[model samples]
Target: MCLLLLAGRADAAPIGYSITGGSVDIDVKLDGVVIGTSAGVALTGDSIMMDTAALTLNALRIEIAPTLISLSTHFGGFDEISVESAIIEGDITFANLWSQDTGTPGLFSVGAGPLLVTGSWGATDSTGINAGTSGQPITFPVPTITGIIDASPGLRIDSVTMHSIEGTPFGEAGKHLTIVASYSIETEVSIVPEPGTGLLVAMGLTALAWHRRSGSGAGPAPRG
Candidate 1:
């Protein structure tokens, strides 16, 4: 019976967690000075999803500032720019969070890895530089941002921080773009039990019951 119980536990399936609530913070900087900042609650709404079983993310959205940012400095010989429809989409994977903590048994803390960010921007130009075509969207590759993950208290991924600097098409010689973002998410983790566990439990219980019934039915141990 004990062995059966252990086996059932050992064969437990990986958990699946869904994001319940979260917020996003972003900063857009040019030449080490903040030009624009965007902060808002994450619009999960069934669009943004995470799967632990496969270690994949689906349709994650990060919102940027809606207002247009007019830069005093010019990059790539462009000025008086209008930034629109700025958003990020990408995939992220983490170290095993399901395993027991190496330092402390029964405790789990999964570490994070670099975030590969890529997104689109609406193209609109009036004075100096034009980004992509007017009707078409401009797509750019962002640098891999270093990130940290915290799963305190349970299997839920509660907090994340990302910051990095990368070159931009708008940047001229010796100029760069800086991006910093952070996310705080609330999640609920539920386990998906393995199929064989129930069968094993039932078999163990049935064998135990049969043994007890046979013992109780003995007539005074056959009078010794």
Candidate 2:
């Protein structure tokens, strides 16, 4: 029989974090099985945490940060700027709190994760840099940024990656641009029992114990 075993407490307290930028996509796992996924919301960089104290789960992942992806640009000498790409070049750092020793800060690492980029572009003669009458963007398809990433075992990670997309508009040899965009992250979190369910269970058990003890200690029903 295949016996899956783990050696950590799934009921550990939540780890606090503050996202400086970008939204995140979160999923949770228990014993290698996915329990559920939650959509990420934009944060104002406030210190917060994902609660995991009542869970028996053992796995967490940063599945995909699609919402967190962003774009920045730097352009000069051009009168018009077209953001043909969301991310031209960038860097991101991730941290896995599950792998660190208790009471100490966790270690961080870099991963070459999924990204988004441009698939095509128009040239200087295709026209539309300076003489283009209307300011309608020449649309380009977004391409998938796929690749493998590296990380340590026994860790729950939350990460943010930042990228800068730079480009020079066609025919406008004098315009410049400096753009910055942050990419979304995909991550997995630990799952626990339904919210408030664990607490109710604990309370029920305690009440039951008190009732049993009280009955056992009471004398036989008062003589009628």
Candidate 3:
């Protein structure tokens, strides 16, 4: 016989978020993996949010890429700019409140790589010089995940990353800046069986076994 326990109360989960910025491009990595990127998107806003489904998640690693764009006029002789950034957020559910502390129920990390800048510029009559800058690498601190759990409740997380880039006019030396930002959120759930259900199943199996044993004994006595 097989016995099944009742479902236990759902425990609240923990959610967290992290943000980072760069001069030209931004890369958002979750749990040491890249999930998303944005180029020339603009960073005027303090934060941005992305759909969790857009990210690649299988057990742990997340992969992402940046969006691109083009410009009509060149600033400081630069024809175009590319910006990128990374952001991550999400929640983890627990079977029960005690389990959350006893076991590592929810935890996550965020990080950023060096900024990459690439563009072209032309010389003007006044300065007689046109120059462009290529992409460069940069690094930033990793983000940490933290949150509190609730009784039989779900957890929510929100995070955003921002980036910006600038180009200068050849002769005038005036610069134009481009910015981009992105964000995302994730949610996880856990389930457990209740004590009462387990006990009920155990009793049911025991009763069936006893009844079978008594019936077999009666048949043997009749045969004798």
Candidate 4:
């Protein structure tokens, strides 16, 4: 539980980031039965941090599997178990991130960037059978940075590199099944600031002091 609301006057600083040597590879399926041909997985937390309540629109998704072995006396007698598709990569570094001031004008603005992801997966069986198929689930989608940064006083994210792919097939085709997997991840970010160039430099210094006090006829002076 966390909450913060600042529409003006700055005061929203302190972000974070960290992740190192990520890894994942999975491809195993069962129920629409396919086993013993697809497996690769790795993850144990190298690094991860992005503060301010996950940067507003928070989100974090992580999944890892393996721990099912009930053969039922071999040969055409197995019931269910499944997994497929997963890959993650690592390397992340961000600090202070953004948001010093850039809120409410054309309607809200202030942000920092760098986060990319792409993922997918499906499989669940025990007698409740839930088949699976739809490769490509390793992740990448979140990247945007071109100036405009304050990053909340001081942020940090060190490393992250993950990879995952999954598949499985059993029953006549060289049967020898045994697989296990486990891993997890989820993150979100969004902070704002950067618009109209500080209200056009405060209206160009109040129109250049009203054109230098109306050309020094002296009806304006009074701004120390």
Candidate 5:
């Protein structure tokens, strides 16, 4: 789905994202603080890095759709927003587009300005449903991911850097691989409610009334 792009907000939730399933190493930081990082894991065909023709950073956006929080914990326990994958598609043109593990070429810098992230969120839980809604993909017995979002900047082309460590699957045992990125970060999270929750509630109330008036609970007093 299309993400959001708005000016900076003073009151926004600290946005967070995650990546899963890939044989790669990556670390993302906002300014100097590390928000998300990965050692050397083996993910399948995940994480896409594309290049953009826009020579300069003309626009920026970050977006995060509020997902379901498991309701089976303690009176609706602290469920986590699991991020399965991440798609970073923007235009980042440094100096060297191709390097062979010779230690980051020369001028290593990013575009100026606040790295605005759309799906990243405008505020934490600020965009979620505060009231109870219908049942999501999360059920009692077995649970499967109900939603998937691609916060992709959608501005692509090419560029990448790989670092192989020892003892990794691609090589020996203790070797691994990794990719790294750095930028000034400001984040926000939103609560994207299930559109069907409202309808579910209405139906439930109607059912309850019908049940109460079904048998003995039906009809009024005998005009007494």
Candidate 6:
């Protein structure tokens, strides 16, 4: 009976998670010269329950409120490059990568296979001449990102770090922009109990109550 109960518990559905709080670190450079920097923006997002045993990622989205960046520059007859209402988004794809026990029960580290991330940003010059989406949504090449899963006591993501470095074209020909971004997110999740599971729990409690009442109502046993 105990073994059967354990098996039933293991068959429960995957757990879902929500972004509690974290930080976003973004650095932009032109021709290898640091031009703009942003750190400490609040992050909010959600993730569908991923298979913990399989180490697979179904879907995850992280977003931040619009922020601004301005830099003094001489280009396109504009005195400065202004990026207003800039929002950053990060996404993850691929499945069934790697996982290992941290020598501690319910504490495991997992990674995504062929981890592909898509990011997007928008910017325009002061005159709005060099307008359009800032280049294109940067598609990160296959990179291995590691994160911790604290399953003991509860199922939760302690922290995860996503980092990438890539280059894209700039305004003038022959000039390029280097983007280095890192997002560190801390998350926690709650399990959504199935209806059947809840019903089963209620039934078990009722049975236990009946058994206790029956025992209490019984007359004292005769001396053996």
User: What is the C-alpha lDDT profile of model 6 across 49-83, one tens digit per residue?
Assistant: 55556554444555654444554443333333222
Could you tell me how far off, in angstroms, the CA of residue 200 lies in candidate 3 after the best superposition?
A: 22
Question: In order, what is each prediction's RMSD in angstroms?
Answer: 7.4, 14.4, 13.5, 14.6, 24.2, 6.7
Write candidate 2's Cα lDDT for 111-222 as tens digits.
Answer: 3322332222111212234342222232222222222122211222242222222333433353322222222532333234445545656666777788889999888878
TM-score between candidate 1 and the true structure:
0.49
Question: After TM-score superposition, what is the CA distance of residue 162 in candidate 4 from its true location, in Å?
Answer: 4.6
How many backbone collisions does model 4 have?
A: 79
Candidate 3 lDDT tens digits, 1-224: 33322111111112222223222233433222343343433222222221112121211112234344343444445444443323222223211111123243332222222222222212222233544444433222223322232222222222323332233323334342423233232323322333355576667789779888988877545453
The clash number for model 3 is 21
Sequence-dependent TM-score of model 4: 0.24
| Clashes per model (N, Cα, C within 3 A) | 0, 42, 21, 79, 36, 0
Candidate 4 Cα misplacement greater than 4 A, ranges: 1-115, 118-163, 167-193, 202-204, 211-215, 219-224
TM-score of 6: 0.53
lDDT of each: 0.44, 0.30, 0.31, 0.34, 0.27, 0.51
Lowest lDDT sum, 10 consecutive residues, model 1, at: 152-161
Better of 2 and 3 by lDDT: 3
Distance from true position, residue 116, model 6, in Å? 5.3
lDDT of 3 at 187: 27
lDDT of 1 by residue, 108-178 (tens): 33433223344333323456346543322434443332222234312233223232333454455477755
Identify the candidate with maximal lDDT. 6
Best by TM-score: 6
